[model samples]
Target chain A: MIQVKELLAILIASSLVSNVVLSQFLGLCPFLGVSKKIKTAAGMGGAVVFVITLSSAVAGCIYQYLLVPMNMEYMQTIVFILVIAALVQFVEMFLKKFVDSLYKALGVYLPLITTNCAVLGVALTNVQKEYGILAGTVNGFATALGFCIAIIILAGIREKTEYNDFPEAVKGMPMVLITAGLMAIAFCGFAVLN
Target chain B: MSKSLERLYNGLVKENPTLVLMLGMCPTLAVTTSAYNGLGMGLTTTAVLAMSNMIISMLRKVIPDKIRIPSFIVIIATFVTLMQLLLQAYMPDLYKSLGIYIPLIVVNCIILGRAEAYAYKNPVIPSLFDGIGMGLGFTVSLTLIGIVREFIGGCSFFGNELGWFAPVGIFKMAPGAFFVLALLCAIQNKIKIEGAKKGKDVSKIQSGCNSDCANCAIDCEKRIDDIEITQEDIDSTAKINAAAIEKELAAKGGEK
Candidate 1:
């Protein structure tokens, strides 16, 4: 089906050319903050992945089934934000109840993801692109995957940055931003394919 | 200084949403491919921030504490939608360029953060001015970054072509955004260091609810030092840097 190819393109585009952290800058807060350690970065990325994937699908469905029928196209921002916030909160509670270890890793970040622009951005992009639920879900997953890939790589680099003697002024966030710049440059190779 | 002016100074410099506080990085980095884009995004966010701050401050008493967060989001989102429609109608080019970012502004931490931290607690006028100051701070910083990126990457400023050196294409791309921002932050750190060495008192700044807990507050009384390094954590060089930035922040804080 044509849907399959469309899905593949969305996946490739979001994960590479339009990467959430590197290119689109949707999740820079967590990218810079949590990336201090590989473990935390991976944990945050996993939570975002779960959250974004489900949010895109649910938001897409809500728009298609509910908002469209009610002449409420303008309510997209409010509706999507509420849905994503509720969903993240629910996931946090659900994880706390059933999966203690996973929750511990991602516990604090759950509430944080509610305000993260990426989840909301993905949902909005899904609407703008007019993609069906299936494609939107795929795009959301791929975008979050891109976030993980970039954050994990940055975390690896940051771990190494600990050994190097940074200049007094270039310590902390400045150095990390520079490292991200280099990584973003490497990712730019994908733009050619786009 | 008057209370109203203090709030403006706080948002503009002392607790700048972009530079000092680091509240909203998504649009800050993504849209600064050009100075014009940055200006457009900055002004749009300012309008939304100012309006939402006033509206939220007005409703602060009515909205109960338990549901405040959700209420604030609705208030912010509504303004963002209104701004988007107006922009779409009046300035289609700017609208086209600043597409998803307009909607993304609904989740912009600066607007939501200010609403929760300042507007909810403060009176209507001070909160409104707070929004303006923060919005101006964000605009200035974003414009500066955009100018840097534009000149380096696109070899232009505000869409105006400069008939000079070869444009480094990288500065216009994603990597360029990171590189330019890093360079600016480092320069700022240098200024902060020098200011501290002069033997002056200092205060610090915030962003993001997840990691930078000390700086990003749902309330105004954030303990910035706990989140960032104190005077003791760094050596003489960094200590001086901290003082320098603080001096600047305090001066700005007091300017009003």
Candidate 2:
């Protein structure tokens, strides 16, 4: 039986201890790309949280119902990616029709989300962990939250760093990366929680 | 000959897949803990990239415009699955080292980026070379990052088992990946800055320039045009002034 406290711990651990960004390094593309501004970072974070959670749940269902029953597990990667691409397209169209402002804000990133590994990573990781529907959904949601928290923190820090004086060599991306390194080191302290 | 060479050279330095474009950071950071794993991952990706690019270029005409994205995903996924199976069957050690990243190659922006940007428009021969060039560029960058990280974090070069280097364990961890990537980006920026300082005439490098020069110039020119149109010369000056005065008074009263 999964206790509420255990679920909370899993959420905290996924967000801080085994962060997909700082720990596993699963989605550094968007981490570095969309992190220049906190607003955009938050938008990307929300989109990621929505995509990862939704895709993982869908992927888990498909894996459990179709692939596992038919013994066609080798097709998991292809199937998951196809599913993600379709989902991204659907989300993009839906947003454009119903939420024009959000569509304008996300703009290119909406399509680029198709290539973001974090969504696929969450799905594939759920399969690897062999979680049931509820567990997979919970893990997926928690992991997405974890990703959101990490990116938001990094974005906040990056916003502050942009104004600070630094060497020319380490001025832009290098300093952001160095700050990320320090954040990763700080997150490492959470390893003891497990 | 030089055209193809230019394409090849562009992938390596001018339009580096990783450092400049920032295309495949997931696997770049994940699998670069060791030099050997990095090389293996890089070569595997290159092989897949070349094969997929060739096929895409060969079939670019037949592919429907409506379903292009799905078609590309299928082609890329096929090659990635083939690579996964081949690695599992032949190079079990390297396969194990790369872990989930081998399969994660499907979503890698570099492979799909090339297929979409280069292969779709180019001929087969040039596309093949482009793939090889870009793949090699990506592989070299990943391997370099891996070597630096491994040497610092493990105190060994590709598991040398020698007692020569000092091991900083952070290099083997996630934080080490960030540190190395940051340093590499810094070095890359420094090189570009130095190249510019040397008067190399890198006007073509303006492709990724985020400096907003064009927009700024347009805005400045628009301001000058506005200044040139004095109140007496303007046809709607009275109407415009009345609207502006009313808006200013409204704002002042609203604040009060």
Candidate 3:
């Protein structure tokens, strides 16, 4: 059983120290692809937070109730993936019907989240660490927040650099990568908290 | 060259999943803290890729069109789980080091991309070779990145200490991964430019950006059309568009 204080530490640790995108290296596809503007980056982050938190809780329950009880712990990967995929589809439908504005903002991202490794990574991490439903959901939320933070910062940097003159060789992708590297260095400072 | 050999050469050089195509950046950056870890991750992903490609190709006709994506995910997850179990049983050290990344391989875009692009339409044998080619390409690039990071960051070669010079410890960390990759990419871009200047067939080796900024539709003041376009630029853009059209036609032909 994780204490409330330990949960707080996990929230901080997962968000800052071991960031999902910068440190853990999950979800680089969207991190790089959707980070051109701060608005889109924040939108992507919000969608991720919603999806990951819900999926983590759902995946936790399914693993606990379905996989473990059946003594097929080895099937968690397949089960979690299918569950997450189904959950994303359902969430997309739910948002489209009930929350039209949110659906517009997040709908494009929900489909992409299916292939995002961060969601699956957190689900598997929860299982490996043996976190219960509550703890798993909190960790998932924190990890998504970390992804949001990292991408927003990268977007801000990219926006600022959009006008700057760069060397021909370091023009586009390399420049973005180097900026991400510096951000990673800044985030590495959080490791001292541990 | 035979079609299979062409695929092998294409993957190994022309369209490397990691270096050129930039498909699987997650594992490329995370598990490359050391050369050995990179090699292990690369080889493991290769096994999964090859198997998944073969199986998916064999079952292409049986799978329905509307539900192909989920079907691909299920097949990939099954293979990924099998590989995870085997690694856990035999290579616990690597298993521990790689950690969540093993299962995360199911989400690697390169695998799904190939399944959707090549294996779904091609014959079984060529699809199998395509997987191996792409897998080898990914492995080679990863091992190269690993060697560079490990050598610079750890002052070691595959975990053996050299103690010859002071190590740039940053290279071993998260930031170092990005820096090394950026440097490598910049060097690659420089080589491509140099090759283009020499009038070699550098158009075949386009960057991930593809250098066709006009059609990208980004509303930037520095867009390619806003700037003075060169003869070489037009030629390369034409080549890229032609190749793209050829690919689209082939895909349509396959559907029929």
Candidate 4:
């Protein structure tokens, strides 16, 4: 029997305890790549949150309705990526037509999101967890929220770090990484919340 | 011959896909917890990269320009699937260790970047070598980071449980990955600065100029009517400067 409480627990757990970035380390590229500035990081985070949530639902439907029935589960990776690429393209066009501001804001990051591992990771992980469609979608949204939260927080830290003093060797990427390490360590405390 | 060899060598050191370009960090950091895993993941990526480069370079003329990105994805996905199957059948343990990263290779920027930047313009042989060289550089860097993390975190090299070495335990966790990576990057930075100071013959760096200065000069010269350091430009420049120190080091082969 799946309880609502258990769903919430899973949602919270995936976001903080098993964070896509800090804990699972699935999307370090964007975490490090985009987090240097809070604005771009927020934009990237928003794009990821949007992509991961939608892709999770789509991937879940594909897995349950198609792959499992045809014994083509092994093709999940290729299939998921293809779906993601198509979805990103479709969304880009849709946004460009309907929401010009967001399209411009997310410009480069929108396409880049198609390749971001966090989105793919959540899709595969939802499969791994054997989540039902509803559960998977919720988990996907929550996980993306968690990722957005973590990255935004890291981006804020990085913004502040720029003003602070750091060792000459540890000034830039090194220092930011160390900050991420601390953030990950702090996030480790959330394991107890489960 | 020498020119092609120079391009190959440049990919390996001066313009490494992983360190210098920072193209494939997701797979590099995620899979490099141990040297064995690093080697496994690295070689798998390399094989896929080489095959994809050859195919893409050959088909560059035929593919439509507008649909090139999607075409590149399709080509890379095909090679990634082949590698996934090969690993699942032959090297199950390494396959298990690599986990989802094998498939994740489909999206690795290094592969697609090569297709767009190098392979599309180059001949098959040079593209092939570029793949191998970048792949080796990635493998070497991953192994180096893995060695440090494994040794410091678990107090074990590879998977051997050392009785004499006390495990830090943190090294095995996610944060350890960041810490070790950061330290390696710092060391990489130090080496590059030292090399530049010593006047080593590195072609990657434009010695006398800052990145913003170079870009500014280019923008000014190219677009005389346009504004050169817009707010967006400033933010990106700041980001570039922050990342450039480590990039300079990675270019010098001081990290791996």
Error of 3 at B167 (Å): 1.6
Model 4: per-residue Cα lDDT over B163-232, one tens digit each: 6777888887888888877876787677667777899854553211122221111112123122233667
Candidate 2 local lDDT, A40-97, one digit each (tens): 6787778777777778888899999999999999999899989987888898899889
Q: What is the C-alpha RMSD of each candidate to the true structure, in Å?
A: 9.8, 8.4, 8.8, 10.4
By lDDT, the best candidate is 3
Interface RMSD of 3: 5.3
Candidate order (DockQ): 2, 1, 4, 3
Residue-wise C-alpha lDDT for candidate 4, range A83-182, written one tens digit per residue? 9878988999999999999888775577656666778788988887799887898889888888899889998988776878776667777888899999
Better of 1 and 2 by TM-score: 1
Which of the CAPRI classes, incorrect, acceptable, medium or high, describes model 2?
acceptable
lDDT of 1 at B50: 94
* Candidate 1, DockQ score (0 to 1): 0.47
User: In candidate 1, what are the lDDT values of residues A1-194, reduced to their tens digit?
Assistant: 88788788899999998888898888777787777768767877898888899899999999999999999999999899898888888888899999999898767667757767888889999999998898899999999999999989998998887879889999877898889999888898999977
Give the local distance difference test score of model 1.
Answer: 0.83
Error of 1 at A59 (Å): 0.7
Scored against the true structure, residue B77 in model 2 reaches a CA lDDT of 87
DockQ winner, 1 or 4: 1
Error of 3 at B132 (Å): 1.0
DockQ scores of the candidates: 0.47, 0.47, 0.42, 0.46
Instruction: Flag the better candidate by TM-score, 3 or 4.
Output: 3
Global CA lDDT of candidate 3, please?
0.85
TM-score of each: 0.87, 0.83, 0.87, 0.83
Model 1 preserves the real interface contacts to a fraction of 0.69
Residues B41-147 of candidate 3 have per-residue lDDT tens digits of 99998889889999999999999989988898899899999999999999999999999999998888788888888888888888888898999999999898999
